[model samples]
Target: MQTSKSTTRIISISFFTLALLGCQSAYYGALEKVGIHKRDVMVSRVESANETQLEAKQQFQTALQKFKSVRQFNGGNLENIYETLNDEYETSAALADKINSRINDIESVSDALFEEWEKELSEYTSESLKQKSAQQLTKTKSQYRRLIRAMKNAETSMKPVLNVFKDQVLFLKHNLNAQAIASLKGELNNIESNVATLIKQMNKSIDEANQFIKTMSQ
Candidate 1:
């Protein structure tokens, strides 16, 4: 079977950096011995993070829609409505948590890869080649910095949005009456606005991720 162009390129990079990872943790050592490398893992994590952000964007929209439904609640099984809203909030919370973990995993692999890259730069015998490698490392790092910052900016909004969601769910659980839902009626605009802003941030982060991937590949 033919290896993907990108996978082959990552494998070729691993061939060079494998030595730089000397006596590293068993986790990395074992993976390196096979076909996977730090760069490969970093790329994988980035893709996972991108997928998560997209999922989160959708979930936020979904949750907002569920919240909007509260304004239209006209004498039904109040318990059922509360349960549905609660489920949406719970799912949104879980997605937010997953996004956080993915970002952390990306950062962990990123540091490892960059450290190995820096060390490998010095191993070049020719000054011209060493300088080129150093320049590439610097450029890649700059690009990565932008990508990580965008991701973090998006994460910053997560908690506030989640807090809003949690508060609504808790309020609904405590008081399943019209008054509790009436309070939610005014929040639809604010909730919609916040989710819209979050989705925009996520969109930017996804763009940055794609750019970073291209920078690394180059």
Candidate 2:
């Protein structure tokens, strides 16, 4: 009877040890699976974020190019006026305002959080320009054509400008400002010459656009 009791105790201990080992194996397997799942989730999230950022960057770059083209045109228009009547300061101010407004639009659109700002900017420009007499519309259109011509000229002269812009982008990427406002005065003068030519072309286009609107209204 004593021998039977001792054998029974040994069997119970063996069974408990096997059961504990089985539970530990299962726990470790579950932890490994959880770790793998977590890793996959993190990878997916990182890929998604990278894609979003890349797309945003591409869009911003395209938009910036278009904006620069427009600016070149506007500068040409201002240049014509400045050349005809040396009102450098006034022209500079106007161009500065225009550039700032465009930059704001670009920045707002580039950032996902500032999308609403882009919408407001569009609304503001549309509304502000909506109320115009036929003569004013005509003049605006003429001005737009002039601006376009200026842009074309600026584009032609843009080998150096392009280089500068590329350098500026690199600097901006590193959170640096490439040129000071005072320094930009000279650059603006050079830019103005190109812009003046574009402005003439743009003015004509604007006139045509306005005329089309008028016709549609009729």
Candidate 3:
């Protein structure tokens, strides 16, 4: 059983690589051949997206701390500060991009699953069972709407935060002096507010993901 599961995992991963490269049809076909369906893909993608959001939350928290540290700068080597801040900005941007990609992946899988579910409803010969399954699909679709909206809200919130980070980094690149640090100090409050809002939205998105995962498990 272990070896069988391991082989399945390898095949699934290989197919996922192909899927990521714009071969989603092939990916779904391969998975279906292995007894894996779009519903399973949705569950897996949601789980991954949840983990990625958690990671982004932590990364943004660190960025907030870095911003705070820069605001309190009474330092000698300001270039070192610029370098560190630049690195944080780059990492945060990369994370924002990753979260967006995950959101897209979740949407893709959800679309395929829900479309298949809606289509398969007609295949049921028994009316009562068909009605029940149809209602379940409706409920699941509603929950997914809430989840994706929250995910998108969080994903969009990252942009303003990234803009602030980028502006500060660019400003410091040309003017690495006390005056530049003073300017950063002025913008620090806005940065804090934006990061706080971003974190709040991420928490909401994460909570939605957890609820969706429960629905999937059921």
Highest TM-score against the true fold, candidate: 3
Better of 1 and 2 by lDDT: 1
What lDDT score belongs to each candidate, Candidate 1 first?
Answer: 0.85, 0.39, 0.91
The sequence of per-residue lDDT tens digits that candidate 2 reaches over residues 47-104 is 3333332333233334234324422342224333223222322333344344334333
126-175: candidate 1 lDDT, tens digit per residue: 99999988988888788888999999989987777888888878897899
Question: lDDT of model 1 at residue 178?
Answer: 89
What are the RMSDs of all candidates, in order? 11.5, 26.7, 9.7
- Please give the range of 10 consecutive residues that has the lowest summed lDDT in model 2: 105-114
Report clashes for each candidate as comma-separated counts: 0, 36, 0
Better of 1 and 3 by lDDT: 3
Better of 2 and 3 by lDDT: 3
lDDT of 3 by residue, 1-218 (tens): 35798899999999888777567777898999999988888999999999999999999999889988975677788889889899999999998899889888998888778888899999999999999999999899899999999999999999999999999999999999988899899998999999999999999999999999988988
Compute the lDDT of residue 115 as modeled in candidate 2: 34
Clashing residue pairs in candidate 1, if any? Answer: none
